[model samples]
Target chain A: MVQINAPMVGKVLSVDVKPGDQVKKNDVVLTLEAMKMQIKVYAPADGKVVEVNANAGDVVNTDTVLVTLE
Target chain B: MDQLWEIFGGIGIVHLTPGHVVMWLIAFILFYLAIKKGVEPLLLLPIGFGVFAANFPLTGLTEEGGLFYIFYHYGIETELIPPLIFLGLGAMTDFGPVIANPKTLLLGAAAQLGVYAAFFGALLMGYNVAQAACIGIIGGADGPTSIFLSANLAPEMLGAVSVAAYSYMALVPIIIPPIAKLLTTKQERAMVMTQMRMVSKTEKIIFPVLASVIIILLVPKSAPLIAMFMLGNLFMESGAVERLTNVSRNELMNIVTILLGLGVGSTMTAETFLTWKTIGVFVMGVVAFAFATASGVLIAKLMNLFTKNKVNPLIGAAGVSAVPMAARVVHNMGAEANPQNYLLMHAMGPNVAGVIGTAVAAGAFISAIL
Candidate 1:
């Protein structure tokens, strides 16, 4: 299991993946909005998403677990 | 009957002039822009109200010992509020991008070409040097710096210059895109910049101090704004002064913004604001913004010629110091050209640097003129 953590402080703009969905390394898993700019968060490795911890409009801090992948 | 006539004569409407009515129209336009259009409402709303109140004849609101007069006199004329605004700005700003990529500082500096362009333009239009200097700073796209410089150099032109600076800043999205497009090819706009290196906490904490020392040393006249700015940044980056940081960026910022806006707005009396020069300020302001945007883009292209890592020339337009707005514009432009390109973070380096660049420019003007 691997946990995908937020790269920085921002509000989650969207979560692109769900549990049981497959993602390739570097695939955008979510979008975060900070400083009025939207940043795409990429998957670190190939994985099947197991749990999503944040929702659109949720403010997240750096290192907050955003998704758990198996 | 004579007493009744005297009472009627003392009424505000009896004192109204055509110029006062014109000022009211201008104030209403500001109101429409602030409330209906939601453009820069925080400052414009109070400024609009200030304009409205000041225009009412016999109110004494902008006279000696009046509320707005006090705000303008102690807050702006004394050179207090703009620096305080910079304090809050510094606290809110994150200099990580600038620390990670110092080269963007040049992009910030290059944008100043617009300042000189406007300065020369203003001089050609027959404004005295001080007034031209104040007008030139409108190109910096920094409201506080423009206010600071105008208050110091040309208090008479403060209303025109501040209005121009903030109006143009809110119009960054509209102003930057065409200029950026005109200069860069589709391929240059589409270039993807790599992620900036992570900046350590030590680097962040040290940056404000080093920058303050260096910048103030270089431009001693800038010490007021730069010192407070770096101090506010220190509060944020030190990790031990979170409380101070919070207040500086939030409550203090809000309080000062109201005072600053109202003070600036109150200065827009019909006698002061309704002038051929006010129109000239608006014209030169747009010219300054366009030149600043073009110069930033051109400098980025110039830097590309020598650098190994190709920078998306779109990020250059972010060097006008409109904070996240300019950066967001660059990011959106980059995304439109190439979906994979995320220039937001890369643009931030120049965005923040532009703030410093503008302060230094204002300081240089002050040093040379005053």
Candidate 2:
């Protein structure tokens, strides 16, 4: 299992995947808005998304786990 | 009957002229753009009101001892408000990007080519060098710098130049994209840059002091804006002056913004704003933005020739000092080309550097021309 943390403090613009959704390495799983720019969060490795800890409009920090992959 | 006529004669309606009516229309346009279109409402709303009030003849709003006259005289003419605005800006800015990638500083400096381009453009159009310099700084896309430089070199052109600067800044989204598209190929725009190294708190804290010493030492005339700017940044980065940082970026900033807006707007009287020279300023303003945008992209591509880690040339458009607006524009363009590309942090380096670059350019102009 692996937890995908936010890269910085930002608002979750969207979560592109949900529980059980498969993602390829470097595939965008979520988008975060910070400093008035949209930043995509990509998967570090091929995995199945096990959980989404955030939603659109949710403000997040660097330690906040945005997704759990297995 | 004569007494009644005398009373009526004293009212603004009796003193209104076609020029005053035209100015009212211009003010309404500013209001619509601010309230309706949501374009730079912070400055434009107050400036629009200032235009509306100042045009009301016999009100004395812009006359000596009047309200706006006081705002203009003590706030802008005295060179107080713009520097205060810089204080707030510095407090709010995060220099982590620039510190992580110092080479982006050159992109910021290269963007100043637009300033010089517009300077010569203004001169060729027959403005005196002082007025030309004021017009040239409009390309810097910094409202306060434009106001500061114009207030010193060409107080007469203050209204037109500031309005031009801020208006163009708000239009960064519209202006940058087409020019950025025109300058770079799709492949270059799609280049993905690696994540920048993390900057330390110690580096952030020392940056303002070191930058202040170097910039002020090089351009002594830039001391006013640069001094207050670095001081405000110190208040933020010290981690011990949250109160001062909060006030500098918030309360004090709000107070000064109102004064700055009204002060700039009060200068937009019918006599000063409605002229052929004012038209020239608007024309040269767009030229400056285009040139600045093009030069930044070109320089980035030029730098790519010698560097090992290639830069996405589209980030160069972010060097126009429109803050996150230009950076966001670059990010969007990058995303459109390659979804995995995150150019915001990368673009921010040049974006913030552009602010410093523009200030230094203003300082240089003051040193050479003043």
Candidate 3:
């Protein structure tokens, strides 16, 4: 299992990955925004995106999961 | 013998009086304003219901062992509720607009003048320092913040302070316009603004972290409020933290609001609420808010004299923490002046800035007094 971690404290401005996107390590899978700034969430080890945990405009705390990778 | 017989019959006995009825009517009016007029109903509903419940004859709703008593003892007495509310508030706020255009903080700063002004006004009206402080907080126009201050400073005037606070908040839509119009000329209101730079995703992410440090370090008392707001904004901006944001903005905010609303309303009772002092507080509150709004617009116009790029003075109205309401008002008013003007997005810069400013001003007041 691959874990998606919050790169920063922010709201999920947009989710780039759906339930079934194949991703490589360090691929941008989600976008997070804080203070009007946006950031992309990167994938960990190479994996297929199994489930996305957040939709766009959801607030995320530190170290929260953004997706499930298998 | 006749009085005793009538009292014993339980027929001539009325526990609630005309004054209590007036309070209940006021509470219902609040409900109507919230439901029909869209004034902070999330809070007005619980507060209104609590008022009605407490005002009902012989209910003991706020007495010992009552649920409201329990809530008051647990939170309001210790000043826990306001700070906790600030936490959820922090989690829900978007500080980017304020950060992108840091100058709007001054509008928020200007609005706080009402608070201090009310302080002096109340003192002259014969209230001691503590009572005057409670009365002054009505200018802040935040229910919890006002309740928190009154709970700390003057427990005697809780009902009056709470009513005045919420009442003025409801009146914001009506109260701000005349002041807004008076402060800015037709030319100032019709002025166009340079489009704000589309803040990058990276800048948005850094805002909360950077601001928490800058603001909290400057005003430690504001840590709870400013920190919480920035944290909420962080959650909203963080791509990875969806669940937390949803919880903070929705479930968490909703639940706390219910408790806060009712708990605050319980403070109002016939004995505590019906007084000439309450009237004084309400009047002073309106004057304070009007002064605050006028100060903001006038200051913006003052700034307009120097800037190469013109700014719509209407954005100054966003300095109040009523959130999107004041911001929306700025947008509408700007459109009224010029149909082609698109000020909503531009006004948001000061709109969100006002949130932070009000919290800071509250922090400053809490710091100075307590």
Say which candidate scores most in TM-score.
2
After superposition, the stretches of candidate 2 with alpha carbons farther than 4 Å from their true spots are A1-14, A24-28, A42-47, A50-70, B1-7
TM-score for all models, in order of appearance? 0.91, 0.94, 0.77
* CAPRI level of candidate 3: incorrect
Best-first order by DockQ: 2, 1, 3
Residue-level lDDT for B345 in candidate 2 = 79
In order, candidate lDDTs are 0.91, 0.92, 0.73
lDDT of 1 by residue, B302-330 (tens): 99999998788888899999998999999
Best-first order by lDDT: 2, 1, 3
Q: Write the per-residue lDDT of candidate 2 for residues B1-370, one digit (tens) a residue.
A: 8998887988878889999999989999999999999999999999888888898888888999999999999999999999998999999889998998898999998899999999999999999999999999999899999999999999999999998999999999999999999999998898988767878899999999999999999999999998999899989988899999999999999999999888888899999899999999999999999999999999999999999988899988899999989998998898788766778878998999999999999999988997
Of the candidates numbered 1 and 3, which has the greater DockQ value?
Answer: 1
Worst 10 residues of 2 chain B by lDDT: B335-344
Which has the higher lDDT value, candidate number 2 or candidate number 3? 2
Q: Compare the candidates by lDDT and give the number of the best one.
A: 2
> Candidate 2's residue-wise lDDT over A1-70, tens digit each?
9888886678999999999899998899999989966788888788999999999999997679999999
| By TM-score: ranked, best first | 2, 1, 3
CAPRI category for model 1: acceptable
- How would you encode candidate 3's per-residue C-alpha lDDT over B1-370 as one tens digit per residue? 8887677646423554897888888889878978998777887888888888888765666889888887777768777777767666666666656666667777666667767777888899998888887777676666667777777778878777876777677677788888898777777777767645546678888988897898888777777667777777788887678888788877877787788788878888778888888788888888767766776777777877887666788887766656666666776677577643556556666666666666676667678778
After the best TM-score superposition of candidate 3, give how far the Cα of residue A40 lies from its true spot, in angstroms: 32
